[model samples]
Target chain A: MAVFKPATSNLLHIEVINAIINAIVSGELKPGDHIIEQHIAQEMQISRAPVREAIRELAAQDIIQFIPRKGAYVAPLDPRNIEGIYLLRSYLEGLAARLAAPRLTETDLNEMYLLNYQMGEASLKNNVDTFINLDLQFHDFICQHCEHSQLKKMIDGVQLQTKLFMNMSKWHLAAHSELHREMNAHEPILEALRARNQEEAEMKMREHIVMAGNRLLEYLVDNKSSKNSKKEDTETVKN
Target chain B: MAVFKPATSNLLHIEVINAIINAIVSGELKPGDHIIEQHIAQEMQISRAPVREAIRELAAQDIIQFIPRKGAYVAPLDPRNIEGIYLLRSYLEGLAARLAAPRLTETDLNEMYLLNYQMGEASLKNNVDTFINLDLQFHDFICQHCEHSQLKKMIDGVQLQTKLFMNMSKWHLAAHSELHREMNAHEPILEALRARNQEEAEMKMREHIVMAGNRLLEYLVDNKSSKNSKKEDTETVKN
Candidate 1:
């Protein structure tokens, strides 16, 4: 759930797509915000051709939307879809962890141990961004070690959706106390993998994702309900 | 596994995407076949703009591949990737069937029952196309009614890979005897769904996919081994 770095490819359209994605990930461009093709072209100091092509590609990827006469906008993070993303990620990540278990080198386990230790320090300092970076790095290591490209791709797509709501930076700051809960979840998965227990590794990883997803959704719902009540109070005052 | 009817939208690019996919699915275009933008444009009587655009989109989706100097080709269906696809599909489809069990109406069960019955007939008649279509239909019904768009999308993407190998025609023709095994697999899924047992439904669906995947891979491996042996025999004869 760390901030998305733009793709490092040299292709202009790909660069444009990553730049536009960077804006959305950074909160500079919120969901449902109209994407002006001209504005993006101007901002990137590039011609509209690659920018236009980027938008078309993004739309095809479901990363953006196109309205007939209205141009494109960022796709909103639907709570329902977010839930589904977590469920899919849980199974897929579990599969990744399971597959990577036998293949994990001693150096891989050592790195994970270091990452877990860093996560603990970041939690104590209340540095959410650093904590999330480590968390994503840890997961990414497992995904990278996975033998299957298709499975890795599926996991990456769902995790991107998770970024829409969690945004990596903000959520970790807000949920400092809950970091221990996640720490608890990660322990079992790491242990299972270290022990090379594929079944346990898969289930524990799945459980970790499901727990994190439920916690995030609960936070979102609570946040929404509080905002709704505040809006009602302001409306009453106006009346 | 049925012929991919193109998207009905007025978008020219979507139509182009589907037309190209249809050629791939129908075996008119084999893996690694070059997709000539101007050729398709001339064939479809449209400009090259949309065809070019469609190629980019499909490349992003992994349906096509772009090589720097070689131009775009259909993404080859690797034996390794096919195994990964089935494993992922098993989990996702199982998830769909689980979510769908409690939500399935009487009509849904009855329809599935009829579909299952028809699958038996197709197997007995050695009707591969009909069998594959019905197989897709049965799975699609569960995915459509699963109440999760994201899960359905993931399932659909993996199933597309299956088409690369099966293509609804040749595989069935060669593996005629194995059709009955598939029939045996479908029976338990229907029974579990009809009984409204969520746990049983999920496990059964997962098991069914795993079983079918194993059979397909076994058949493919056998085919490859035989071909390689025949090559060795021909070389010996030449010597």
Candidate 2:
């Protein structure tokens, strides 16, 4: 057995946390799946201590749930949770846009414009992952001009929560198309920001967030319905 | 070395986390104050494992910062962070009002009314702690009624980050008066919810959050200036 070591770096825990987060987001670690610390530790060639630390960290963020004497499990995406997250996202993104409006440099506008171009290219090439990445980057770029770390962190946390859902629907061409539409939506926001119209920027950002939420909800509902049908078919065949 | 006892209960970690969180919120553990795992473990009479787990958990939530090779410390509040948090809170609270407007029950209204009454009592008694607690409870009541768990969680997280700053200005009776005004401000929200007027409810909630942010900012500025003056006086005496 490997000897335990006092944690010299939070880096190990963070790395493990990120790995698990990515696994969940990528659907490799599905909701309700048990996470055995020993197994993970062995796989990663580390002590169970760091693995345990990572699991607890993720649990605190509601990304995972731990049951006493049982084990840690990935958290399921509850629709109610999604609704709450989206509501906050809309508000924060709106604020970010408003702040960026007055402070957006020419370089900021150019970067946004460039991001939109890259998004179009990704969409044409049918690269959903690239599209999603660019889309998030574009939003982050806009938020960067806001000069508000707390708002950015809040927004980042909410966005991270939504990433798994977003990734789950990545295979859908319609989702890609919706993302393209979202990219186009940024034009009005960019214009408003460039004009230093805080109200307009905020309004546009709110609308964008609302639209994004609706799109995701639509995808999730459809995905659930299809899943239910598949389960029903399996049950009928058993009968 | 204590042999690790399998966690008897998940509540232990949660309880420890809450204790640490309370300590931070009450200013018993100020920003940047190092958290010694062994010290807390000894005080709580738990093993180092659980304490470490609690620290990791809080660190994940960004309520605490863990530096590699250093140790865990209460996360410091930055003005920019505060600004971002308020922006997000305003939007989330606004959305909560909009959602709650359509679904609010009579019982919800009654609970809020009772809380408002208690807030008034607390303010009258000049109990800052009681008044602040009631103020938070009042807002939380609305959030709960809205039935958006994700939004509620996000809002609660932001609120936790700023609670220290809010408490710092207990000397400002105007802040207490503002809380009274805020309690009354809920009247419009209650009316809008009772009437199922989504727009009105959203408007009222947004205004209340904005006003609250403004009041907090004013208090922080005053506190900062006072501190600055004290520092300047100390420097002059030394010179």
Candidate 3:
């Protein structure tokens, strides 16, 4: 909780929000853990005002929750909510790809292919971190060419939500099959971009995201059912 | 400039942001007008810290622009940027309509129709303010049923951008033909929703937004060209 250093940034509240989000991603702040603004401020050697502002911003973003009189807590991940975010990502990124297709040059397409190839290698080597990073880069590269700042901004926000969830569930992508499936999903998108077919590119990009979301949803469902069965087994043993 | 009263809200930054936006929308703060933080703080009878935070927030949202060494000013409107916002709105509100169509009841359909009827009446009576307000309500009513909070949030944000531009250019919507077109666009959307035709509903909603956007774009182009012609005529007279 006291991991934050003194803040000297011009935008102290943004710094606080990023620090808190980093703490959550790094597992130092687990879901349902109370976020004491005064404690954070003291840890950062700053006044409590910025910390309070950060908490309010986080709550607005759905990354933190206020439980009435219970104060603020790291918001618990909901599979349904994550699915909604992914669906939004699918639509917006699909729009991005459509907008980017004609704008993307040969150099850009080659760079995307290079990133995809590296992602394939990383997947083979079980380098989930590198693979995940490259996947984001690939998608971001296309989004950057969309020529729509607001669209890119909305997509970035949606991607941040996905990033938080993925950090908490990296094991899902750790499976070799999942990694390969993820790597392969980019094929049609790249191909469509190569041909400058906006409609196909949009559809492929959307399908890729929908597939990824479905895989995560399946994992969540399976894990929950298995946990329920384990709990039943424990109750039987106790009986 | 000193229109704001003392702030009493716990989220003072938000209050400040809203005050600034209201001032802009009300034509008190025009585009390119410098935003003075200390002045705003003094006017609101609050400390400068929250006003500073509000400015930072506005800058992040693109409502304020920061020039190096010159501080912040209200962001100037760009027709192209507004067009992009409308395209994003088209896609997102289309999504909202699709998700909402299945969830909307018979009563909801009737209510939407009633609102549309009222909009027709308002448009005929040249009640631009009431017509505009009801148009937002009509869209918001459907969005409220979308069952996707994040999606709704994004739509609300996009709508806010559109709202700001609309406030600046109310003359565009005040035209009798434009008002009627705006009012009539809701008809097909309502019919599709009443039939629970998700695809048709989405398409109609998207078309409605695109049509509205095109109308606005036309007005902007016509206004700019007319201004140019006026300038040319003045220059000719001088010659």
Candidate 4:
């Protein structure tokens, strides 16, 4: 686990949980790796109880799995699970876009526009992280105006899951190059919302999610291929 | 907690988790009740560790909240959370219904029809539990035919959260009476899907979810009133 010792007097479990989640999301903890509580506690200089609590918490979110007698392991990202999450996200987000269209204030539109511009700047400067952050901000800005708290939470939960995939795919040059196209896609969506055309907004949002999902899947396939190749090379060298 | 003999050796944590969940769902463990791990373990004739593990699992799902020093407590069903879940479910299930409609085989249709019929029968017999089970079966059947694993998982998760509200509402007679209407609502959805009319299928499914959400909210309001009145009566007697 990535060691960053910080003061943790309150909510020790939550703090530890976030650290482990960040480690997993940042690729410091690979899938199927055993998460020994003692190791984590020692690294963080905390008791094993809090670390154990954090592991259990992660397991509940399906981010990890605990086998009795065996230890806790990072949950593997199953493509099927990704597909399921994206599919639901697309439909819910499409609804959010539709609901937000008629109700989107001028301020909401302006905020989205500003975010989109910043995203473009980030893309031009080849700042993938900034571009990604802005991209998330733009979508979130629209969701903020949706007036449906339930929809927003559901979308946010799925978005968190997708973020892991997004981080993994960030290493791909083509993925970074698609930032401009992504920004363009948001323009039509914002325009539709500004025009109070719910159908158009919903359609655009669905298309955006579908396109993103497809791209992420492609990146995953490529990543898997490279990983397999590397493994084969190691085996051949050993032989 | 419902007493279960310790015949089953494995799945200890799951069993404990299910027992506690059942208490919450059954209203035996009311919201705000501090979950005593020792008390629960003694009731279920299990060790404290499994109970603690179960509590952690529940906390992760937001079914309960864990307090340091103070024990875990059943999470109160927040109306906002319910609304958010319903909104997301509406969109996702709408998509599933639309997708499943055209792809639904004769077997799928027959299965759904049977489930619906069984739901009606259970409702007529005033077997709310049986009716609810059939109702879930009907929806799950639709999701299975939808052929989207991601959609199914999302739907299932949303349904799980809604179960608490659904159980509370089950106490009301009108909620029980609406079973037939709910079954009828599925007819047009199935018809639209069978006819390969995706738009109609989607519309019907969305309508179904919206109506269910509305009904559940109304039921929750009534449940709250009844609970308040009962407390008032007790206070009056004490005075």
Candidate 5:
């Protein structure tokens, strides 16, 4: 189990939810990991009531699954789940880019440019955490300005799930070179936005997202056989 | 105030949620209408606690809005909010059609065809309720077999909201001819599915959804000026 510190003093359940999500996104918790509410309560020095409620909330979001008599475990992932996330994200962010293109102010474009540049710098230093954070900001900037509240909300949820599963499989560690390629892929999107070319921006954004999904899928497939054979061994050792 | 029967004896709060959602979809509850928990509790013969919880749940889903010290109201309509819903639905249903193309059974295709044909019959009989119900089934049938759980979940939520707002505006009251046109729109999607043409199915489904969105947008825009002028009168009389 990952060590958890008490989070901010908003509603205790919401804080617990954030802590669990953060743990999953940081690769400290992997799919199929059993989540014991009591242990989490003890770790955070909070009552089990809030921890249990947080687990229920996560389960509602499909981030955790409960088996009869088995209690709650982190949702076991399927490749299709990841693909579904990326495919949906691709269409939505593509829509966002198109909407944001005509609406982009100079400041918005410059902010995105800076974020992309920082992502490249992070990749160069092999700082996966910084790169990932910057990557989220780069995408989120366009989405925020897309002028669609519904789209932004959907994208935010999907993006977090994407990070959670990607980190579970060590997605960043497997693709150092690909990180640079991915960071560089943002240039065409930036140029399209700068030019206020909606169609070009939408097309480029979709392609960029699909490319990343494909790379992750390839990595998962290539590692699956070895991973499957060692799965039991790993589970026993890790737990 | 809309009369609500006590729903199934599941959790009282969940039953309250269903009653409220049903009222909205049936047009008994209109946008910007205040939600009084005490009245709902009285109507349903339940305690105010469950009604309050239900309001909180609806507020979380964006179906209800809270104005501090003013209590809860059904979320007000915005053209862009409707557009956002339809646009996202278009892309998702398109993806669902594509994924379901090869996987659809003979029975599944036949069921869709029957549903489409039934929608036409309902339209010819000028039964808006039956037509709308069939329309949902037609699209939902395709989506259910799409082999993607996440996509189905999203479409379900978006579709419900679509119906809620559309019914609020009495969408069927304004367009008899367009009902036939929209019913015919499902034909190409059905044909594409029968042919097992994934790309063609995707394109047709997207076009079908976009056409519906555009038609609704046109209706809303044309009605806007008059509606704006009458807004105060309508609110006073309706409440």
Candidate 6:
């Protein structure tokens, strides 16, 4: 939090928001840490107004939460929330794929193809940041190109929460094997879209999301249980 | 909008927020209409601070929109938006049902049963207001009782959009037969929940929402095309 220096952008509020989001997503700002607008304003050498506005905007977007009388904090990730949001995202993104498939132009396909190629390369090179960036781009492209603005908004909300979950769990699929597996998951979805098969595109998209959610959820549960037992083990040793 | 009387509550901001929401859901506040903060404050015989805060809260919920320099306005309901939100709600509510089945106690089930009974009565009497309230209660109950706070937040958001859709469509499931059909749709979900059958509850809940969404979507499409052709007919007559 202390190290964060706001990057300059045309709109100070937006720039502040993005900087905080980047910080949170990168694990620099951990969950449950209070987000002080004044501190950020001072650090950025800007007025508190933009920083406050940025916090408000982020709060509205569910990336930050303000507790009554407690101030804003980076919201903690909950397994139940992750499960529910991922489930919802599966359906919404599925619909996005369906709507986007038939409407996709050659250029759109080319953009997606390029993104996929870069994602594969990043995965092979074990470049976690590049891989994650490409992954965000791939999903963002679908939401952008989708015909429904409301659907895109919903997907964006889900993605925000997904970032929180990923940050909390430190589950970026950093391992080569896991990254490779995830990279492959996007192909059938793209193929369905490229072939203009709306139903298949929708189904494949939903399947991919659900599969990934299940994998992450399983890991989360395992991690929690292991941590609990480790705490119990510590108690026994102390005793 | 003129008929609205502000409800007295401990928190002026919350009361104002609720009053506006009720007005919107009841169709007193039409879409695209500017919401005057000063007017609301004057009407409520309170200061504008609470009113402004209420508007900001509502804006955060996406139940209201604030345009830069243009002030806040009721966002128009788009059919595409409704389709997207309803799709998202279907998956989320389905998960809630699955998680809630085993957790639902005898009292919870009884409360739902009573609500369902009242809903049927409201429909039989063509009491649209009561029916709509009951419908909201029914969904709110599921979201509230769901184990996940985050999931509850998501469902609440979806419900907000659904309210906007319902208001925009003037859809109360008004017809006796349609109400009856919708009432029947809930029975299977209830039965599954009663039996603690998670899978069945989820499947039935999803089916019910999707069916309702399909009905609404069809009507929206039909209305749009008819409006378009009507415009064409008028143009032809003029020419």
Indicate which candidate wins on DockQ.
2
Candidate 1 lDDT over A134-210, as tens digits, reads: 88888888998889877787777666666666683366445556665555457788899899999999999898888
What ordering of candidates by TM-score runs from best to worst?
Answer: 3, 1, 5, 2, 6, 4
Q: What is the DockQ score, from 0 to 1, of model 1?
A: 0.48
Best by TM-score: 3
Per-model DockQ against the true two-chain complex:
0.48, 0.55, 0.36, 0.52, 0.39, 0.26
| Higher-scoring candidate on DockQ, 2 or 6 | 2
- What RMSD, rounded to one decimal, does every model reach? 6.2, 6.4, 6.1, 4.8, 3.8, 6.6
Tens digit of per-residue lDDT, candidate 4, span A79-186: 766765676677878888988988877987888888878877877777788878888888787778888755665566667677777787776844457666665667
Q: Which number leads on lDDT?
A: 3
TM-score of chain B of each: 0.84, 0.82, 0.85, 0.78, 0.85, 0.83
Error of 1 at A168 (Å): 7.3
Q: After superposing candidate 3, which stretches have Cα over 4 Å from the reference?
A: A6-14, A53-60, A66-71, A175-177, A226-239, B7-11, B56-60, B66-72, B175-177, B228-239
Model 1 lDDT tens row, B14-127: 788888888888776677677777667766667777777788877766778887546899887677776777888898999999889988999988998899899999889888
Tell me the docking grade of candidate 4.
medium
Residue lDDT tens for model 6, B93-167: 987898899899999999999998898897777676677678888878877877766567767867887876765
Stretches of candidate 6 above 4 Å error?
A: A1-12, A45-50, A79-81, A165-178, A217-239, B1-10, B41-53, B164-178, B214-239
Model 6 TM-score on a 0 to 1 scale: 0.81
CA shift of B83, model 5, Å = 2.0
**Residue pairs whose backbone atoms clash in candidate 1:** none
Scored by lDDT, model 6 comes in at 0.76
Error of 4 at A18 (Å): 2.6
TM-score of each: 0.87, 0.83, 0.88, 0.80, 0.86, 0.81
Worst 10 residues of 2 chain A by lDDT: A230-239
Q: Evaluate model 4 with DockQ and give the value.
A: 0.52
Expressed as tens digits, the lDDT of each residue in A86-170 for candidate 2 is 7677778888888888788788788888988898888777788898888888788877778876567666767777687678677
lDDT of 5 by residue, A20-43 (tens): 997777656677788988878978
